[model samples]
Target: MAKVEQEAEVRYANADGLADALRGADALFVWDFLSTAVPDAWHAADRLRWLHIASAGVDPVLFPELRSSDVVLTNSRGVFDTPIAEYVLGVILAFAKDLMRSYDLQREKRWQHRETERLGGKRALVVGTGPIGRAIATTLRAAGMEVSGAGRSYRANDAHFGTVYPTDELSEHVGSADYVIAIAPLTEQTSGMFDRHVFRAMKNGARFINVGRGELAVTGDLIEALDTGQLGGAALDVFDNEPLPADSPLWTMPHVLVSPHMSGDVVGWRDSLVEIFVDNFTRWAAGEPLRNVVDKDLGYVPTGTSRV
Candidate 1:
């Protein structure tokens, strides 16, 4: 911020001050990606030309008005890919080894020995084929999992994911996977995608992991699936509602591991996020195309865009 602020006038705004701050702003940096103040303050954005969000998903910032406008939208894409992928792999290993159960036994001062599942021969189906999903596939493959992908369309012989299935047909293909992971962005076509039908289609005792937006899965249906033993376990980092309300059953459910939405937020992540915005700001000031520019129509950065 110091580097960019030295060259351009920077205005800081919390949700309340956003409308006043955006009145004459030419470009806006949405450091708080989850704030819903932009849509309410749209009337004040008279001269805004560029907007950059600090997170990969732009659903919270892609209001109807901005989607239709000429203002270029960009995101901090490359920063989270590898960190999130490693987090996914860590949870997968934990599930297979029943680390949670061991911890519980230790707390109870009991000793028990049990065989654990092996990750090498397991099948994994990763939804979303963006850069983050590709990174996940690579990491899982390195650990010896037979990896596949589900995305907007079907493809074969891909580099990271061996075979990609169309997301619309995901239910038909999920039965074969030992682990099903969701890392897709939230969009009109993707919201509430992993519903009861999809859950029921998975092989009995298959585990589920989600590091993407919470809206990607139907919360009620997910609880039912776990309660009925249709799913062996679930390691969730995001939820339908943040802070996951106190009354939520997920917090006490057996075989369920709930984490705050910090899957990609490793140490120094904030600094890395700021660095990405600074680099893009330099490009914007030099009249060069910005990196990680999102395709608002698709609600994500396109495949051929400048992604690291």
Candidate 2:
């Protein structure tokens, strides 16, 4: 890497100091996970030729001005795939074995044994057939679970997923699923896409998992689905509101599990991201086409939300 060091100007560790380096930089790398502090800083400036965000989702950087610009954009897509797939596998197994129930039973000092479900033969509908989705399917299948992948378009006979359904057919497949996992991107069409109508359509006692954007699901409606017995269980790592209000009732919901959106994070997250940006940086410096370029119109259309 040092051989190409001279070709590189400055790589901002994050968006904080990114704007300051732009005047002397040919390309800028902004790994700002907290927010798109740089995109907002240089919206009207012409110095920024390309902007790279370290997050898998680019909604933070997709301001109207940046969207209308010719600046090249990219994201860290495959960096967190393995860890997130592992998280999903853990949740699937936990829910299937009623791990939470066993923990509660232990608290009561009960010595009762109960029949529990296995993931061996159950089917799962993994929405958004992107890198993260495909990784999840592969891991789930390895654990003996049948998988179905849903996406915007259907191709002939996809081997990874037992069934491939068009995006519009999502609700139909969801109705019969043992597990409906939302890993879809947050776009105009997907925003608030999972509401009362969609939840009420799922099979009785089926699990609904959302590692995607909070805007995709209605939080209050999710509570209603569980309360009404329409949904068996729900595990959410994201919420419409971050650092969820301390007073919200979701914290006390009986069948609901809430995570502060930490599913994709693991040891070495920052270094791993730095490595990916370094590789892509090399390509950008050489005038070669960059990978994982985000389509602003699609709004983070590339991969699933791994920072669940």
Candidate 3:
């Protein structure tokens, strides 16, 4: 970024020195999206006018100080859409083809043949209508699955989602979907939204996938659902507590696939994030509206807004 913006002075600081570093900065680029340092250092932001985060989800940075401040906040929204969508499709295919079991058999040198489920005509309900969720729906649809979406409100005709049901109708939809994918943001109303009732409402053999915030799901409820055979399997990318605690039972679940929260990351993701910040910085310096400006109160970039 410094290479392109030669006239700008860049200051670097870790979480420990962030408060001191923000004393007189004009602009801030939070490269470490997971850090909770911003809120702690916000009081020192005397000259800060613009803040750009190198991530799509802004939950980590949506502290009261920043949310109520006048400082413009932007994020790398479009950067993660395609990569995460592709990751969702890969996992779906892995489940349908029983690839994990095949790999286990191969490692054991055992000749085991099994019937794998077909992807065609399966129903998938994506729980977020954001770009990432839309991308996943589109890719799943193209793979011969029927797709629908659920959002904060109902929309008769969304550009990407043919029909979007309101959050209130989620339980009704869950019972029928073969795959229930949670990719919604972390908001007041959505936190811990998926609990025992939601899981029990799902189809008996449905598979659950979560690429959304970890707090959105109830871990104990999910475990009960899986153990009781209410759910066939689960693929979890995010967890309530990251690194997911070594003693967590999810690690030993045969029907569960656990991964670090990296669905949106791909090769050169850091470069892509930097490119977004640089472009937005150019616009900010010129007093022009920046790209991926988040609706701080909503915790996401509003729908239908054009992105660079």
Best by TM-score: 1
- Structural similarity to truth (TM-score) of each candidate: 0.99, 0.89, 0.97
Q: Write the per-residue lDDT of candidate 3 for residues 1-308, one digit (tens) a residue.
A: 77645968778899999999999999999999888899888889998988999988889998888888898889888888888989888898899999999999999999988999999999999999888999998999999999989999988877777889887667877888899889998888788888999999999989999998888889999999999999999999999998899999999997899999999889999999999988887877788888988999898899888585
lDDT of 2 by residue, 52-72 (tens): 777776766777888898888
Q: 1-308, model 1: which lDDT tens digit per residue?
A: 99899989999999899999999998999987888888888899999999999998899988889999999999999888999999999999999999999999999999999999999989999999999999999999999999999999999998889899999998999999989999998999999999999999999999999999999999999999999999999999999898799999999999999999999999999999999999999999999999999999999998877984
Give per-residue lDDT, candidate 2, residue 148.
Answer: 88
Return the lDDT, model 1, position 179.
93
Flag clash pairs in model 1.
none
Off by over 4 Å in 2: 1-7, 11-25, 34-36, 301-308
- In model 2, the Cα lDDT at residue 211 comes to 83
- CA lDDT of 143 in candidate 3? 90
Q: Please list all clashing residue pairs in model 2, or write none if there are none.
A: none
- Largest lDDT belongs to which candidate? 1
Minimum summed lDDT over a 10-residue window in model 1 is located at 299-308
Score each candidate by Cα lDDT.
0.93, 0.77, 0.89
Cα error, residue 24 of model 3, in Å, equals 0.5
**Candidate no. 3 TM-score:** 0.97
